[model samples]
Target: MQIQLEFPAALATVLGMRGLLIDGGGTLRETFRRIADEYPKLGLHLFDESGGLREHVLCFWNGTNTRWLPSLDVAMTEGDELVIMQAASGG
Candidate 1:
């Protein structure tokens, strides 16, 4: 399967592109693990020391927040889209 991943500009600087087409078929967690393997720097920004997604990092899986999903083990399909962003903060 080929999944589409979109990143914010700041993260894109690390990825060298705002969007990426990843080839593989697996659960969401596995796919992210693959990305981390390929881009360690970007992984730092996306995952915490425990390998879980950082609190401030928001990932939308096909427009629905991945956090809202039942599990990160949700299977990914061809053409699935994932949009990653940093949650806004401060007043």
Candidate 2:
């Protein structure tokens, strides 16, 4: 199955803002790992040494936050749309 990936903000600098077609047929974990393999930079920003999402970034799929799901373990199917967005904060 092919999934649609969209990157936002600084994240988009690494992977332009648009739909990226990705093949995902394995477990979600494996699929994410595959994405990392394809774009090593995104993985760097997505995780820290402690293994948590960076405070500056968040992920959403089809208008729903992935934080509510298992994230890397969330199952993916064809035509699934994902967005990698940077969280906003200001004083």
Candidate 3:
């Protein structure tokens, strides 16, 4: 399936583009792997040294945080949007 990726300007600067479309995977993990393969630099900001998602990074699948989903193994559908953003915090 084709997945639409959206990112903030800061990240877009890092990625050298505003967004992208990629052949998604059966599972979110697989999608991430594909993204890593296509954009290793962007992947660095998304994953930690141990290959875990960075604490500041949030991935929203179809407007829902996958972390609250029953599983990250959720399958992708055509036109599914995966939005990547950094968490915000302030006093």
Candidate 4:
């Protein structure tokens, strides 16, 4: 299976690309682990010290926020897209 990844500009700079295609199957967590393995620097920004996703980072899986998902262990299908964005804070 292949998953698509979309990153914000800041994070994209770390990976040298705004979008990517990665071969992944199984749980979402496992897919992320693979990404972390390949792009450690981008992973730093995606996950926090506790190995959990950062509060300020938003990960949308197939158009739905992963945070709102029942579990990170949710199985991902081929062509699923994961978009990473930094949460906006202000007034």
Q: Write the per-residue lDDT of candidate 2 for residues 1-91, one digit (tens) a residue.
A: 8887777656667666544788877656666677777877777877666555667767676678767775567677777777778888896
Task: Give the lowest summed-lDDT range of ten residues in model 3.
Answer: 44-53
lDDT of 1 at 76: 92
> Over the stretch 1-91, how does candidate 4's per-residue lDDT look in tens digits?
9999999998667868898898778899998888888889988888888777898999999999888988899998988999998889896
Error of 2 at 33 (Å): 1.8
Error of 4 at 40 (Å): 0.7
Q: Give each model a TM-score.
A: 0.90, 0.73, 0.90, 0.91
Q: List the pairs of residues colliding in candidate 3.
A: none
Clash pairs for candidate 2: none
Model 2, global lDDT:
0.71
Which residue window of length 10 is worst by lDDT in model 4?
8-17
Residue-level lDDT of model 3, residues 1-91, one tens digit each, is: 7999988888878868978999986888888888887889888888888666788888999999867888777788899999988889996
- Between prediction 2 and prediction 4, the one with superior lDDT is 4
> What's the best-to-worst order under lDDT?
1, 4, 3, 2
Evaluate residue 9 in candidate 3 and report its C-alpha lDDT on the 0 to 100 scale.
86
Q: Count the backbone clashes (under 3 Å) in each candidate.
A: 0, 0, 0, 0
Model 3 scores a TM of 0.90
Question: What are the runs in model 2 whose C-alpha is more than 4 Å off?
Answer: 15-19, 50-52, 70-72
What is the lDDT for 32 in model 3?
82
Root-mean-square deviation of each candidate, in angstroms? 1.3, 2.5, 1.3, 1.2
